[model samples]
Target: MAGPGGRMMMGQSGERSMDFKGSGRRLLRQLLPEKAALWVMVAAGVGSVALSVAGPWILGKATDLVFAGVVGREMPDGLSREEAVEGLRERGDGGLADMLSAVDFTPGRGIDFTTVGGVLLVALAVFAAAGLLMLVSTRASTRVINRTMYRMREEVQAKLARLPLSYFDQARRGEVLSRATNDIDNISQTMQQSMGQLINSLLTIVGVLAMMFWISPLLALVALVTVPLSVAVAARVGKLSQPQFVRQWQSTGRLNAHIEEMYSGHTLVKVFGRQGQAAQEFAEQNEALYEAGFRAQFGSGVMQPLMYFVSNLNYVLVAVVGGLRVASGTLTIGEVQAFIQYSRQFSMPLTQVASMANLVQSGVASAERIFDLLDAEEQAPDPVRGARPGQARGAVALERVSFRYDPLKPLIEDLSLAVEPGQKVAIVGPTGAGKTTLVNLLMRFYEVTGGRITLDGVDAAAMSRDDLRAGIGMVLQDTWLFGGTIAENIAYGASREVTREEIEAAARAAHADRFVRTLPDGYDTVVDDEGAAVSAGEKQLITIARAFLSDPAILVLDEATSSVDTRTEVLIQKAMARLAHGRTSFVIAHRLSTIRDADVILVMENGALVEQGTHEELLPAGGAYARLYAAQFAQAVAEVD
Candidate 1:
């Protein structure tokens, strides 16, 4: 049966043994959060089992009393004909009285209707009481386990928030999702079904064994032999099945990951005509899952029948020996009957324990995986309290900045630059030249390895992350809009409630108001997930409007106008010119013409600044910036021709 802590007793060796204790301890600790309710449930379960166990023994006693009454003999336990008749009369049971009066009071001849009827009624009442207690216990357990799981789910969500972006970069989205959903669900089911089954089984075994020994120690001793044999069988099978359960869950995660990738990239797969290839990969994963699952289930499946076989042998032995004892005049038939029933009862829990072994093993494996996630190293803790500056003039400087995704290979080194307030600085470079890394450092998305970046002469790290980000606004090329009304999308970057007028003004500032008003709902038009209903250019405009609504003192525009047509680009350029008039703006672009009027054009190559000057000055210098401008200009001419 399910053991304490809701684990099956796998009398095994190696990791299985340790898993039994370790996983059991952790699961118990999780339950302790709802311990008060759990304890009450346990009490009810105990009472229910106690009442149920009393049934067989009471029936056995009543059997002996009735036999003696029919024989017109007094019971050895002090029950007599006079007492039975008197008790029947006291209860005013006329039907029983009439039946008893018809019987001749001859030894071992007729039934004692009153005593037998009364005893059967008592047994029914006892059984009904037990059933009620069981119902209450199960209901309480449901509430307790569900609430505990709810708290665990909340903690997992909060834990995900505290983890670093780097963690997500290294982890698979589907695998993480599987842990949160499937793995946790396994634990929930195990607690609900296996826990109560285990508790009831254990109580039944204990009560039945006690009764067995009280009646005849010889019969109990024979039944005890099967216990060790059953244990050995369980241990051997459990050890074999444990690793398969691990493999089963691991394969399940891989299958989920593959499905997620296929679903997310279904269009790409179809365009490439890779449906056959995709099916092949899925079949491989599915086969692996099937193999592991079959092994795990088949291994544990053997234990129940094996234990039952041993139990059947024990039952036959008890019956044969007990009959012999009755024939020798040392045991009553009623006592032998009770002992045989107890022998059967003793084996049932063992059978239950064997049957639940697979569930318990799978649960432990899932729990271990979940705990691994919970114990993963989180991001370095942010300061509990830090500087929250009121205002910023937007002067930014980087000194001796160096960074690398990996320590062995550096991506950026000694990247130093400075920008005064209200200056438009454009950073231009080819792909993989670290143009975006600078913005990442400025935003503290990734920490610099070597040097400090400053905002208005103060080390940016000295300020809280919230305070640092509050003073700057960013508009990225990959626009993101949630499922909401257009007005909500525009007001997303705002810190407080935004009125309709303000949202419209922000849209106008981004040159998006005209198109927005043309929609059926105007600013209230609903945007689907990923803004799929809108064109790429319109999505970019929505993001620009969101940035406009924030109105930070500093702005970072990374290819903000790349998706729009020439007309929309020109409008956006004019709008951005107004937005950046007095703010320190950092512009990153590939089209050199977009930043021709920037106060300073910084050209980067291979993670270091190679050229920095006004647009006119850099063109005359014939340096890296001049070459980039000429290449782009020639490409544009070639395209037009």
Candidate 2:
């Protein structure tokens, strides 16, 4: 999934996307807080492996005890002792005859059942203890992993808040969400299920190697040769497949992003009849995802069979060498049996390690994405000397303020304006003129690159952003109503706690109270994120009510009534007139007639105020404002016809 880095495309073909060494170190650091608990779990796993390793050897000793008892019984029940010795010598088994004289198996009439039973009981206890330890370690690891993931999730959320608004503007919402949810989920799953198994597998391999060496150094050396060979095989395959897994994950993120975009714009797609085009795009992304997934699975899939083959080959070599030693009486049958079990145990963990390679790779890829977000450039820190503008006096002055979203292409340059307290200043210009840019600067959403804007004679930059924004209320054309009841949305920008009576009064002032009462639940109606349940005009009214409730000293209405019908527009204008009665207001409207009553209409062209006067003064100037006004009326007349 995408993160703060936005889109994550695949690396060069066949090249892995992440640096394993760097990501591994970072991942380790993330787990450092839980280190003590992890160590305890590891200790339990080690204990389990140690006990399991001893079981085979003890059973071999028990086998030897039974063999010895059988030999003792056979020697007495057969012909004479001399006959047994001659038979051994004749068979070229002189060593067996010499060992028989030293034998003292006559301590019991039958096999030493008590001794064998004791050894068997001890083995059973050890096995049971090992199982118990394994369970404990598994549970411990689970607990630690869950806690660590929770911390990581919290950090991600905190990091998102610290990020600059520019980051959100550039990053896709779906991609950002993908990182916060899907990518984090992937990391959690891998850490919980794979990490514990990985640790146990390594410990098991070590324990098995120790037992293999103790059984027979010669056979142990033979088994050791396959270790490097198996690892080499796994490494080679994993390297080729690692890129595929990276690509697979990236493609999945892209697919999710595409789906989210298309779904959100589903209405637009239908309006434009672009279903076929959207489906084609979806198919292409899906195919890419499928190919990446298949290749990754196929690459990691080869490791198990290859490791198993290597394991089986090592087992055959050990069996052959062990059989030779046993036949010559240098090693007993029971010892050979124990070595075979050890060899099998040793190879099994390597197979498991190979099996986990894909998960580890995929998890590391997810970690890299998450780390990128945590490492993004944050918003510039607020000045230490900044103070809160508790109550602005509604006076705003812009000096020769120059600003640009991109430095190379200046949008607002050498712009100067003065807004008197309680005056309605209407800003109008062509599409690319800096109408909204001025609002952004005034609110300090984006700081000016040169000069300064002051609110009540205090530099806006010198005031805390929250305080500056608190003094200004905005009703935008694109009304934003979060998921809440009508009353909650209306009280959105209010600085202080608003009672139900205050909310109702604000709604009534905005002319929204009548329509709100028509709903079954009145002010308690639930609105979705997009406010889909309400009409566009109703949403605008709610936003206007929000502005009225805020009752800021400075108000901004950016096409506030653009979405409402003619009848509703008249009501909203009346509400706005009352709301702006005692405030310094900026109205940015394309409908020239709506701003005809503005105290001073600032006719802007290309970010420069070309003319400044009341509506009557600019009507006869035959300037840009006159032309724009004429065109607007003509368009409206044509629409009516």
Candidate 3:
């Protein structure tokens, strides 16, 4: 599924809450595999939060102790002489005498300035240490996130390479490309931002709640009243946002697919004068994407503000309760101050968690899509073990073979044929007579539904696909050229490294050397996309050169000369003769002249061999072959006169 170019929703049921139990655990597992550094970072994060919470409480305790010792001229109210001595021992020898000597009790009760300075210094040290820990953990967590993203991208790409051809046929190229590139990028972004924040937020929440309860259970109870309410609201919002995000992503994929299709077929569209229609269709798709994106992002955007508002309400409640306790002399001002700070710390992390929900939801949606692709069935496994060219005989036989792309409509029914080793067999037929399909079956692009094909008396299906394919060289009607130099295209299918001399020789054999040499870079010139800069005949010749370089035992030329001019076709035919000298060959052509010299001509009609013989033998039969020949030759003679 695709959404718009930039904005994407989650899925159809836009109200479904994030499945924390299902997707959250799965995503964590996926991320954890590469997060060897993350566990250390998590520990550091906990330490940072611990230091932060401890600094405030320790400072508050130290302040009250100094006030009691100096102003009250005794140990703190709750501490006995033994406890006060222990507190002094814990403070260590660092400025202990100066702090004890500066406490004043005669005139006005107050803490020694020296003792306050020492406490402030210790608090500052703890705060600085906490900051350092946070920085290290954040940096380490980010590295883990980036490494995990890189691994995911690589794995997805490898999966694409191994995927079956049928999957490509059924799915849109743009949609697949978006998943592999854009969607994965989004997942990476989400992971990088959310992982560190999530860890820090969780640690902060735990640390603050523990500190609040330790200070005063009653105040802590009041502070936590909003926690469940905030969580409930967040859960509802997240549930509503998940589907919107799924839909947004789906619409984005569809938009990308539409754009890809339109651009790839731009020439055809213009030629047919359908630009207006194409633009209209694109606009409509774009509008649908816009709607989905707005709904998904807008919903997620409201969650953070709502969370903050709830947190503020809880803060006011905590303040009012803690102030009354302080006024009644049950709680010290220092303790009340610490409680308020802890309450804010607790609520702050909740707000951050709420803010990160959208990214988490988006990542889950992307992960689901990626897993779906990874789970698809791969190509059928090759059965033959240690298969190689058997005897180099080049004989092919189809025994009662029946095939169908769809079971309801058979394309080739019970077709049986045999080609002797080194025999040049030409198959001529009208469109849809299964000419190309026959060759495809021989090459094992598709498995036959019934019967079997044999090569050198060995079952074709039993042969290793690579071995079977390596033995046959093909030049298809629509030639494809990669974006590479001329020499590279010619050496495309060679098993071993090919030299420049060999590449040139193959090009010469295919009569492609003349044009290739005339180019600006000769054989080293790079071709544009699909060789769009070159003529169709030039591309075809390059494909022929590639096949010639392979030098297979069998050759199949499927409409190889159909797109070329007559003069070029003649040259190509000459090259084909040289290429097929001692190899078994199958030629499929629309033009009658190209295959007239073939050793055996099989005229096909409706996927059946209606006539089979040499040229002279077929003319005398007065069957379908004779009638076709008579009509063609009669027209040729009339044109000559």
Candidate 4:
């Protein structure tokens, strides 16, 4: 159900079944780094559950002491425990006499408060020690959970860095971000809330079961009869609810995508008067999320009450069977009481685990998503010792290059060009032409499927991506400015530290200094990620200034002047002309008027070079370049009218 590029379409979760047990094992394996701490947690949990389980058995001894004292006081004076049992048997009360035979008491003595008090004190100490051990277990579990989460987050970040640019180009922004943030957070919370408790619950079940069988094997069997029923119920509900949780998370991602797209382009939505349409789409996604979330929660929610009911049935069976054993003298009153407590202890853990099914299911579902991202294909590793351009003279050439985004559809094929240092080349084409793709190939954002590109006769592919990109400066049409001052934004392009003078000089070269000084804070003015403090043209100018600051051997301006007014565009062109004076420059532009003075122009159409010459020469030939010029000129005339 996954569409192209690993983006899951609607209903994918239903079609693709989740491997609950496999994912559970993998999730636990993520904790291997904290193995020592987990062992400590296990040790503490065992000690805690052991002492806690001892509480009831020890208290049962106290009960027996008190019962014996009370029974002794009821007997006639001067009669020992044996005398009372013999008297009962002679009175034809053989069952009662047999029960009395198990009790130890002196005929004249009342309740032995001293002995009862001693047992009660021991019980209190055992409980206190158990509490302390549980606290230690909880603390250790906290360390393991937090450290594991921290490592997982770092791994996810590193995985993203190693992924190819093409993966990001095809994947939805929401799916990626949701995995990084929402899902990881969910896993963290689930572990924090459930890890210690789950460990204790499983240990408690084992300890309690052991004690139950130790007291009475017959009663232990009765208590365990309902366990399989509980398991069946939990497994069935979990199977039904697991897929819903996956769908719920997927819906969350889709809804996030819609909201982000709408918010980022709110102006466009308003300009086109499609606010209602956007709202409608938002409602649909929200409703789908709500439906998925409700179903997941509701299905898992049924487990707790169902489990509780089954446990109650087990309790009833144990009590009835235990009472009969007591009446038949098979078990004393105190022993029967202890066996009943053990039955509850055993059932309680099963119920607790069943009740936590939702959290476990949700957490594992999120882990699966994170693992998928981590296991995604990464770009090829860089060579151990990649080549670098020799002093970056910037002599660039493409020899018999072929490339495509999709293997089935070629975008650029058998394209070749050469540019000497200090020459500017202009690429002109309509939308979907290979103009930008050509620049991408040269930048090595995408590897060429065939042939080679070389920088100063050194193959680009042989060079490390970082080393290859270091000597190139690019100013994209869609500018990006992080949250910082204008000075910092411009300095981002510099490979090394720059002084205030150098920063100002770069801004001046891009014709952005005069307008910047007009602002309240000048170069220190704070701008957000949206660059809202600056106008559209100002943002573009800042990006161009950033490129100028780099002072690279090669400059790429991809529609860099598209956002500016005519006067600003003319000034930028002049500044770029000066910058291109001694560098290899590739300029991609749609406004043909901007590149008229270029040393050479290449016309591209349908992934192929149809014409190549100087502007004057190509216009005379009346090829693809000439036809594009005529159409643009006509549009300009129509706009003027």
Candidates' TM-scores?
0.86, 0.90, 0.85, 0.96
- The lDDT for every candidate, in the order shown, is 0.81, 0.84, 0.80, 0.88
Against the true structure, candidate 2 has what lDDT? 0.84
Q: Candidate 4 lDDT, tens digit per residue, 1-641?
A: 34346655332334577778898999999999999999999999999999999999999999888888888888998877888889999999998988888777788788889889999999999999999999999999999999999999999999998887777776777768888999999999999988899999999999999999899999999998999999999999999999999888888878887888898999999999999999999999999999999999999999999999999999999999998888887888889888888888898989999989999999998898888788777787788899986688889998999998887898888988888887789999989888988998898877899999999999998999888898999977888999999999999999999999999999998889998999999999999999999987788788888888788899898776666788877776777676677888999978888888788798999988888888889888988999999999999999999
Candidate 3: tens digits of C-alpha lDDT, residues 478-520: 7888888889888997988999999999999989999999999
Q: Name the regions of candidate 4 deviating beyond 4 angstroms.
A: 1-14
Q: Give the least accurate 10-residue stretch of model 1, judged by summed lDDT.
A: 8-17
- Using lDDT as the yardstick, the better of models 1 and 4 is 4
| Model 2 stretches astray by more than 4 angstroms | 1-16, 77-91, 94-109, 494-498
Ranking by TM-score: 4, 2, 1, 3
Q: Which candidate model has the greater lDDT, 1 or 3? A: 1
Q: Give per-residue lDDT, candidate 3, residue 288.
A: 81
- For residues 491-592, write the lDDT of model 2, one tens digit per residue: 886888999999999999989999999998999999998998799888988998999888799999887666568898888788878888889999997889
TM-score of 2: 0.90
Q: After superposition, how far is residue 419 of candidate 1 from its true place, in Å?
A: 2.9
